[model samples]
Target: MSRPDPVFPFFLDHPARVTSDRLELLTALVNGPRFDPMFRGDLLVVPPDHPVYRWQCRVGGCERPGQHHVELCFQQDREWAEARASGGNQAEFLEAATRRQHAGWSRFPA
Candidate 1:
């Protein structure tokens, strides 16, 4: 008896079968209770305040997304650092920081 080829697997031989299996698996995953409702649709539009997917800056009126691990966006973070160095606190910074318009690329289409 001969062994099957490792490079060209039996599943790869049938494209339709593989596609169907993937669709079925995706459907089951989407239907699971643990799945987030925001991702169930064809277009994914996550809310800024989503607990697990928060992307926007937390400062009021700021339109940019947060940096990697911090809640403030890049510009806001820099501004905060400067203010803090000059003896300003978070509350004063939040009240004094200028509001920024959204970046061209960050805007979503209607």
Candidate 2:
């Protein structure tokens, strides 16, 4: 018989591969989608009906109602950090971090 996927059939069926920042964002949105109606590009359209919008896949192809499909959110933040590391402060760092966190969820891998 053929072998199954290495990471499958474990305690967790399918674990998400989002970065630290993305996970933070998702946690915030999942907890309270009303906080940011238009986060990044994906709409936090969490109606009063369904509340638990867990991310199923990492390809962002699934028709899920949330932005949990994305896996990475580092490129933008890295760029921003590099460009402003000279004298940027906490606000700049936060802005870049936020942008990257959401951008990773919306932007497709290229």
Winner by lDDT: 1
Residue 21's lDDT in candidate 1: 84
Per-residue CA lDDT of model 1 for 1-110, tens digit only, reads: 99877755768778668778889999999999998887898999977766888887878888887886778888999999999999999998988888777787766455
lDDT of each: 0.82, 0.43
lDDT of candidate 2 at residue 26, scale 0 to 100 = 78
Error of model 2, residue 45, in angstroms = 14
Per-residue accuracy of model 2 over 37-78 as CA lDDT, tens digit each: 434456444431233544322222332223333222344334
Candidate 2 is scored at a TM of 0.20
What TM-score, computed on C-alpha atoms, does each candidate reach? 0.64, 0.20
Clashing pairs in 2: none
